[model samples]
Target: MLNRMSDHRLAQLNIAALKAPLDDPALADFVALLDPINALAEASPGFVWRYVDENGADATAARPFGDDLIVNFSLWADRDSLWNFTYRSGHLDLLRRRREWFTRMAAAHQVMWWVPAGRIPTIEEAGERLALLRANGPSPEAFTFTDSYPPPSAPPTTAETGTPETATRAGAGLTPPRPASPSSS
Candidate 1:
């Protein structure tokens, strides 16, 4: 699923999203709220691709498996552009008023990770990755602001075949699960 675009191309790609849905009537209205910003982000510098869910018409799905959750995924050239758009640009205004739009979530709401140059991470993959971070901590696959992990310096190397494989999404190289919180001693 890694698309393998150049760093230069990645620099030109713009990607960002809102965490909440403004409307629930048939769900189309939520997309309507996103329409203008999506266009604006696409126009912005460093914009690449966004994970869209056109009511299941799009290839990559962000549809939440549960009723209260929503996920948006996308890629960008670097952190600066994403930071600017998310906190300093027009998008920041929308984010400021998120309570008016989105349902409050108890889990990690937004996250960022580096795909192999051009790889688009699947939603299920991303969701699992997020869960890993929430349950354990950040490694190559998952991280957060309190503990940010820079993208890997080199793609993973395989020892057995002496060749690389697409990074496994099924828990390979994943952080070990956290032990249960001990009862008070």
Candidate 2:
């Protein structure tokens, strides 16, 4: 997946363990929001590309991890771009409600790495990157937003070292996911 990184883009993969089947009534609300949220990401600033299903829609049917899990894989122009879309957009709203639709995983469920520009990373490649991150923590090979590595050829800068998402997170007043009550569903 790394290919020739003379030019690169940020690749990220995040998996969620479903609390129930996609068609189950318990997941209806989550399903309903998929389209709109996906559209938002596509329209976000610095968005490069996203892995979609056969219909050019969201990646709901992608289960590279397991039958009970689904993935969201995409490329961003840079670390800051990904960080802004992830933490400063409407996407964060869904993240807060993750407990309602997904099970808490025992191990790392997200990873970010640099890939060659214009390269479309395969699901198998994503799996390997995630595995690498889980086993070795942050490295140039694989990492996360909180502990990211710069492009193999670029020097680190304040924007990468001291991400602006910190201020955005605090200003947004982000709170932890609360217990999902049956009545709220």
Q: Say which candidate scores most in lDDT.
A: 2
Model 2: CA > 4 A from native: 1-6, 53-57, 154-185
> Lowest-scoring 10 consecutive residues by lDDT in candidate 2?
162-171
TM-score of each: 0.61, 0.77
| Model 2 error, position 127 (Å) | 0.3
- RMSD for each of the candidates: 13.4, 18.1
Error of 1 at 173 (Å): 27
For residues 1-185, what per-residue lDDT tens digits would candidate 2 score against the true structure? 11122478899999999999999999998999898988898998888999976666556787667789999999888898988888999989999999999999999999999887888887788899999989988898899988988775532223434422222211344233356777854
CA lDDT of every candidate: 0.55, 0.81
Question: Model 2: clashing residue pairs?
Answer: none
Error of 2 at 92 (Å): 0.8
Native-to-model Cα distance after best TM-score fit, residue 47 in candidate 1, in Å: 1.7
> Taking the tens digit of each residue's C-alpha lDDT, what string does model 1 give over 1-185?
22222332111111223343325454454466576777777777777777666565332134454544555566676666666666777787767766555656666655566776666666676677777766876665666545665544433445554444444443256343366998997
Number of the top-ranking candidate, with TM-score as the measure: 2
Q: Give per-residue lDDT, candidate 2, residue 129.
A: 96
Give the C-alpha lDDT of model 2: 0.81
